[model samples]
Target: QQYLERLKNKQVVRFASQAPAHPLWPEIERVTLEQLQYARLGVEGGVWQLFAEDGEMKMYKREEEVDGLAVDPLKAVHTVKGVTGREMTHYFFSPDVRFEWETTLEQMKVLETIADDTLVILQIHKRVWPASQRDALFWSHVRRVPNDTDRDAQDIWIACNHSTEHHEAPSNEGKMVRVALTVCLVCQTSIEPPADGGPVTRDHLTCKITYCSVVNPGGWVPTSALRAVYKREYPKFLKRFTQYVKDRCDKQPILF
Candidate 1:
């Protein structure tokens, strides 16, 4: 309690503690790269069905099931004005500010710090009606990659979160049911340089963001109920979060 109060507004510096190599390291690396590629793929493939759209943001999903469970993969693309790729990824990856923007989160904790750019997190989300409370434990990693195709463009940023396990805080040990998810947030920045040849500013930047996630309900949940929740929640989450980041940038120095 004391720590939470003191830590409310401060971003936790990474590498607070070291964790040994994980058995899923190979999967993590593979998934991270795969997501980067998948995210950049255009929606013209005629597979993804568009379900939600607002301004520059569009959300799509493909109906799919795994072992009689609804595990629809979601892909959302959004263009945010006045922020760079680095700024978007920073807010998405930082744990300290999550509560401020993640309206559905009930609690979060860092279970392990794998490196300066990686950490294991435990999060409990507000329960949806007629369903058991849900929790997630995942390893999250953030990195910046050079824009190989567009050398003059600002670097791209990626934040990947994939479900993981922890002995101390095992899932399904309590009333909360665990949800497995793999989420990727990828950002690319475009600059609209000043016509006056002045210095660059946040106003001259726009970040094109791709968010992809596949969540698997650990227990048997009605497919309709799950899809209903996702349809109602995802768009709201993305819009509110991006607005929050824009507001934060307006209030302080932009990360990039």
Candidate 2:
């Protein structure tokens, strides 16, 4: 009862966009509002569907026959609507995709508790960005920069070099080389750390490279492009650039 009371009092600031200059006037569809309400309920109940793709064929009646039975696959997806700046959550359950769901749910719970965590993060962001900054930044901005809607691939590259130039130059000098680069759906340029230090800081930009796979593939490359640089010499870069790529031509312009 106490926890429920506290949740009721949790106020998240919501933003209202300006009306589009169209015949529809307020243009807000009823179905959209219903979807938002359903999403809110989903988050409140922690109501997740336990579904399988292949139905009965995907599973066995008993657990012992590991060799004879087919595997069942499931997806755990939820949404956090009504809360300002919260993103939807999704989990794919393959043969043994368990820990990722636990970790993802834990993250969602953390977001739910903080309420204003994303807003505070945006407020403290080091970049001189506008209040209405692009939405991709809300999720995995740096990782998605290669094919980002707002910034171009070249623009992203410049930002990457500019971001780390101040901190890395004094220490790495000639040792630093352009090993790998990528743009994402959130913003344009993100560079891997040099052979020395792991990405200078986690300040929203240093997304783990493995997760880069989630980003749109149009403008980005796999991290393997930094192959020439030996691992020991560039431990930091090597650590993150294990599968790095070196192109940003794949992204298409975003409309809307």
Give the top-scoring candidate (TM-score).
1
Q: Give candidate 1 regions above 4 Å deviation.
A: 1-25
Local accuracy of candidate 1 as per-residue lDDT tens digits, 33-147: 8989989998887999999999999999999999999999999999999888888888998999999889889999999877767888999999988988899999998878778
lDDT of 1: 0.88
Candidate 2 structure quality by residue, lDDT tens digits, 3-66: 8777656621122222223222221233223322332232123333222112111101111112
What TM-score, over all chains together, does every model reach? 0.89, 0.17
Q: lDDT of all the models against the reference? A: 0.88, 0.20
Worst lDDT run of 10 residues, candidate 1, spans: 11-20
